[model samples]
Target: MSPAPWDSEPRAQGPTGPCGLQFRPRMDMAKLEEARLFIQSMDYRRTTWQDDDGDTILHIYTAKGQREYAFAAAERLQELGRLDSKEHKGKTALLVAVTANQPEIVQDLLSLGADISMCDIKGQTALHLAATYGFPEVMQVRGRERMPLSTCLTPLHCAVISHGATMKAPTSVQGRHTWLVSLCQLVLSLISQEIKSNKTALHLAVKDGNIQLVHFFLKQPLPDMQAFINMKAHGHTALHMAAGLHTSLHQEDIIRLLLTRGADPSVRNLENDQPAHLLQSGEQGEKVRRGRGTSLVGECS
Candidate 1:
């Protein structure tokens, strides 16, 4: 009975951000009722934000963190079965949830049929947003398999670059853990199955020194360390990752795992350098160089 979000009339902006949060600005509740009625009329199809940017009203809410209004609107959309609809950016409601680091919201969207693998114009996916924010929406996983949040970068690599570690799932289950964990686990499983650029999640795990994630990833049945641990992206391996971490329990463990799993300890990067060459070296250029190398493949090898 509901027309697709794409079939709906043009809207001014895409709604995004957190849902159900209290607001200080007193918007017309009557207007909200009207919006709700509009939602029902549209069969929960997302209102389009036909800007040049192509972002939807959903994108606006998630990016800006509008809590309650966004949540209410999102719920209406889910009920109408349009939660996965994308705007001009090729982003889904799941992507917005990942961007906002709202695990519960992410679960809600996924349950309502959001696709986890769609890439945006920027080649980003829900995982990229989660990893970029260091929000491990994954520790909730059970199996080794995972899926891509996007095409340009796996969630693991995204986690490595921004957080200097692995993407983890939230350990706590809370109220929405089942869906969150299932979604996170599915992503993980898909990631494990596909070895992009000849790298597995294990390779990525070691490269970024994500001890929890790395250790957790190895527990999966896929045991091809040499295929990945020894492999190089931009001339760096997980061992190179081991030397240049901020030092945490899991961080140290990832290094140990890589070494134990046969990550070449002596690999170097395009600059003929190793991660050790850049550790804690407060020289201005050193930080920049390290950042550059790490950004390429999740390490300063």
Candidate 2:
């Protein structure tokens, strides 16, 4: 049998510094082809080689964007009982593919029975990485499975946190509005999943000044709205958080949305401060109060 890829010796070179310059010996194509043929013949022993970092050939190929090669290697490796082998950092080939945003490779690995729930040392799963990187298509594939309740965060939290300011306002077109509403529904579904934090996704949305997301929550059925809308943790509602952001451009709109949807403006936080008290003392506060009428805060109180 040909020498394994790892067994190829490095050629010695002249010392470049305290350490000698050791040049890596290139693999002879003839020998590599021989190994490939051996692997094709189901020689599991030779094909299961791992590097010093514990990355199998499948990991290397998948991370290098060698899609076809990675697929074939994955098949062989899976059969040989090494498909999900992890590297030094506890990253599997599937995690690497997701982080690299290689959807095709990710799909191939999933078909090969890669564990979608596997997380890295940092507790980030493939779904977490996909959401954090804004790869919604990849997220759709991995998200079909019921995800474990993420200890610190869910994909919904990651998606909202990673959301950029570039999202344009929906036009008056009915189709676009419908599509946006559907997308928001998906987000809400994600948000409804259990998380470890006391603060809900709406709290994060309000803190981020995500008016669109806040508006979506307001539009849900009253029962669902009551479930999440006025949710209080740390003694603050979404309204309190929005009201506290004196610099938010969308503050008035968000506050109005919350109040109209049954948010209690009179609710006090841990600091014993009401939402109206959190509002800025100036024309801005008067402007918001004026737009909604004097009864806005009074009626809620």
Candidate 3:
């Protein structure tokens, strides 16, 4: 058989024989669609990075303060795949959710596959995180955020007292304070606990002068500090504590937000004094403003 002109001529053949296999590159739409469907069907958690500290995607997401994304990722991972099987640092997804100060997310994670009995590297569970941190606004964590809401009374107040008790003798409890990341999460816990009318997490953070926590709470969706400024414990919101502790930029802003939010300038306490009155009294008065009795003083005549 006579060879083709291209095959006969080495120059025309390019490198190999005439059959160089010149074919157009197809898009492979069918295979691409299959890959997309596979990704959509799989659980997000399965492909998530393993946290260095054994924290799960849920924990990192919560700590990151991505509320909507965190919950949605958890939901998607749960609905499409195994949720209870998820873990980080020997803790389950439920525990991570609680530690992140996400009571609602905690409940949802639990419904999927969370094991309440599971503990973290520090021997704590979701309940412990909820208790330790309390709610950002009310400082309550009675399981109200859960489904078929719990009948138990808010436990955050008790948790704080208990934690303090440990400090009294110097608990030497020997565990990680992993529930905290940003002061924002801590504040949220205090609020969920209905911890108002006492030294709130915001109040505590201010007294501690943790500027990071201060800024964090300020930017939150429902800031605990906004309603808590300048009032002496007898009358002092967080601003009162900041003024007495050592005022800073956020502290001043806290006062403005409180005022704008309508924190009553005329609201009086046992001293029969308003926030303005307390402010004018003296530095010594502001320093002594925070006390155990202050909680009661603010509550009643």
TM-score of each model, in listed order:
0.47, 0.72, 0.32
Highest-lDDT candidate? 2
Candidate order by TM-score, decreasing, is 2, 1, 3
lDDT of 2 by residue, 61-170 (tens): 66765555567778788876778888888899999988766666788799898887788888888877766665544554554565564447766666566654214322
Q: lDDT tens string, model 3, 1-301?
A: 3321111211111122111211122223444354345435545544354445554445555444333344544555566564544454666666565655554455445545555566556655555555564432111232333322132223333344344433343122222122233222432444542324556555555666555544544555664543544334545566445544433444444444444544554556565644444432355444333432222124222
How does residue 6 of candidate 1 score in lDDT?
Answer: 35
Ranking of all candidate structures by their lDDT, best first: 2, 1, 3
Find the candidate with the highest TM-score and give its number: 2
TM-score of candidate 3 on Cα atoms, chains taken together: 0.32
Q: Write the per-residue lDDT of candidate 1 for residues 1-301, one digit (tens) a residue.
A: 3333533433223333223322233334554565456555642123533345555555555555443345556766555555566776677766766665555555544554566676666887666666555554422411242454446456555544553422243333242323323443445542432235545455565554556556554455545645556656556655555555654434444555655655654567677876556454454324433442222234443
How far is 289's C-alpha from truth in model 2 (Å)? 3.8
**What is the C-alpha local distance difference test score of each model?**
0.50, 0.66, 0.44
List runs of model 3 lying over 4 Å from the truth.
1-49, 79-81, 85-88, 110-113, 136-301
